[model samples]
Target: MAADRLSALPDDLLQHILSFAPEREAAASAVLSRRWRTLWRRESALDLDIRPYMAADEGQDLRNSPSPLDALLSDAVAALAAFPRRGGGTVLKRLTLFLDLNDVDSSYDSVDDPEPVDDGRVAGLLADPAAAGLEEVLIGCEHGRMRTTTYGLPLASMACAATLRVLELESCNFEPPLSPRRAFPCLTELRLRHCFFKEGCLQAMVDAAPALTSLSLDRVSQQPPDSAFQAMPAYCWVPFRLRCLTATTLELKTYSVGAEEEDLARIGIELDMPSLRYFRYTGDAIKLSLASPAPGLSSVDLNASLRGEQSQWEPTSRMLVSFSSTRALKLHVNCMNDIIYGEEEHGGAILPTFPNLKLLELDEFFEYTSSSAALAMARLLRSCPVMSELRLNLNMTRWYRDDEPKTNDPARSPFAQSMDRFNRLASMTASSRRVSELPAVLTDDGAFTCLQTSLRKVTLQFNANELDCFQVQLAKFLVENAMVLEEMHVDDGNTFWLDHLCNKLERWRADSFRRRNLTDTARFRVHHLE
Candidate 1:
């Protein structure tokens, strides 16, 4: 025996080590020795993933009997019941449970028959004495694709509201507590994804969680306005107002509604987070408005399409103005459609100057063939006077290239004709018109302070076998113009043309130095994306 040094460690430390293992494996450690038998029972963290224990459903028929999912749930409840009680006992600090029922064929099964696993039993875990001081809980459920019902989590049954600090729930109906006061008194972080809220449940939950500092709502929706619950008091639907005073970081994404409800959805968003420092929003349309300026907000990322309705441009303009104080900014290509076309239509500046911005990242989803993209790039460069780094992600998928060899095989005629039609449509819809010359913002002397002095690093990402002419021109323009640039990185996401791409980039480096009348000190390199 090596003096059993590991066993000599403190009991709490040993339990902490065991907590990382699966619950069943951790409990199995009890058979090792007398000292270890009870140590696993006192562990403070539990991760109950029922996927491994689920029996194979390939050939088994579960129509008449309770599902393995139900069995696992019962086993989990029994395990929780075995933990030590409240007074002077070990307090569970964290619990994470993941239940996936995508393989089960339970669409036609009646809820009254097998008494679909009571959601309250899972929520009641918080009421157990073992969870007296529980601080974190993550519950994720993926129901069968064919099933019509969703799990309804009973929020009122949670008993660790005063001590809980973090909570996350996914794919469920969030039922608000009966009383809002003192609910989730100590909670500081909350995330809800793919969830449905009752008429006013979300508002009440927000009102109750006063100490919350971070919140994320992804694909969260509510029932239609015609629900039976709205019959009382002649319930009039209102825009979802998220008025968090203490939250410093917030994310709202994909707030989608039907076309008939588009006007209501666009009515507006009310945000009152005075201390916010970081904000990221992703959607196809605009629906956000801050109640007041967040003086402390410093970083913002906006990912939305601004090409459709004129109504979206004004709100986007207002949003950019509010984010003028931010130091870092990222914009998707769809966002530039509005700024570029709006500037063309209105013949004026459609964006505010980002005086404080030091870093800028632009994301593109298609091949860059028109000068509208160049103009958009120029306008952004001119706005950020002191930006030091620039990143361009040209995630090109497919496009028409006239230089490529044409196919003449009769067997591929149908597919080739269809692709040619698609190529034409993409080109026509890409921009209303095209121009030959680079925008004056790039050609004129002293037009951009960032390019003249401050800009030091540049990164361009491409995902194609060959670079588009527009892409090559943009790269050449940047290399020849950025006087103080020290490093230029080209991420080659191509599969078969790595060697060709590398050689072409080398030539660009030589040509840029020769054109600029400067020494080429190996300032650029090409990297392959794995």
Candidate 2:
């Protein structure tokens, strides 16, 4: 009955159904009945996963016999070749092969040098003019090394399929002198992950694909030259009209002006794309500048780490000025401490001004004095007139105090009297009085109130025990300012003030009951972990 139902479906629908099944299962389905025998062959998209097939053939001791890896590769190539061609001679729309070639622990010797698998049979299939109609190809394999002479995909044998648009290669290698010369004029998207190329091979590949629009390169390395470091050529002058680019672990040894110039020149070079928005670099810091401003860019993430006796402080600071159009910016400065306080320091005033900026996050390794921090905050608030959110994650673990006391230190007296003075100061500060209005001795409470008004949400994830007096003052300020606040979450872990907070929230608004009722039916729970 199941077979009958499957057969009743239209040819297109049946093909779609069979495409979802594994290659082995799809092939086995043919034996279900006569009508289903050729159904799998009609699938336009072929997905062959070799791991399960290899694992199921456990009884075949090919290790002590002929090479199992070679046999497996041969079987896969043969299966693809056996697929029937369409009336117009087209093979398939797409072909995806996912393989896991990791060696089992059963062997003591290294399997790195597994016998070479001849891909001539597969190359012959790809070379066929009828099979050239394939539009997309994805190949993913496990971690392994390919010989310098062994090319995984034979470009010479591959027919120029104008229909091919997308190609992805993961954990694969291309042999040296890999000049395929075949132009993928219609190809737009190319992704290469954990793949290696011979020197000048990448440039050659990029030159062949003029229509490339989106390119993702991750963990791609080139063979080192005798000079130790040499700048690789910028292959894509205008890669397939590329608009989105993500590059990681691009190892370049030499620093050349053209390398930087070419990179910056292509900032807003897209001719066909208006939605090209993201530009992300997660590896080594490249000294590339923006050519034409990226006025359309909404967000930019730049992570740069440079090595040198001289500081990259000035150059980095200057580079930021180019990204004036970005509304959201995340910058990770590697040598922040060294550069910020160096002898020839470019003043912190060099920090870029975000005119239309609303959200800002600063992750720094610096000790921020209360006065310095306040000044910096004032400048930012003044600059970003519409700013609504600010997050500062600082590492202040190394702050130390001098043994010599300041002039304002309390007299060496009873502990209770000293505590009384401190509490009084806290209370005065948390009262929200103007900075000029602060008395000769400011209270901790007055200081807390002043900070509370500027922040909608403030989270302190460090030790609060040392700032107990300040915490108490801040808690009182929260209670008083509860009307202006929409949400107040305090995670002091010191339960001494939790009850006070709960009571304050309960009495401040009767809407708390409404929130409790809504919580019962909500699918998502906002957990406040203690």
The lDDT leader among the candidates is 1
Model 2 — TM-score against the truth? 0.58
The global C-alpha lDDT for each of the candidates, from Candidate 1 onward, is: 0.66, 0.47
The parts of candidate 1 lying over 4 Å away from their true place are 1-10, 32-35, 56-65, 85-88, 101-119, 143-148, 223-238, 306-319, 334-341, 344-347, 366-368, 395-397, 401-441, 464-468, 492-530
lDDT of 1: 0.66
Candidate 2 Cα deviation (angstroms), residue 394: 7.3
* Clash tally, candidates in order: 0, 17
lDDT (Cα, tens digit) per residue for candidate 2, span 84-160: 54333436777777655454322222212222233454445456654577888787766644321122555555664
lDDT of 2 at 62: 65
TM-scores vs. true structure, each candidate: 0.77, 0.58
Q: Tell me the deviation in Å of residue 59 in model 1.
A: 5.3
Error of 2 at 234 (Å): 18
Question: lDDT score, residue 358, model 1?
Answer: 87
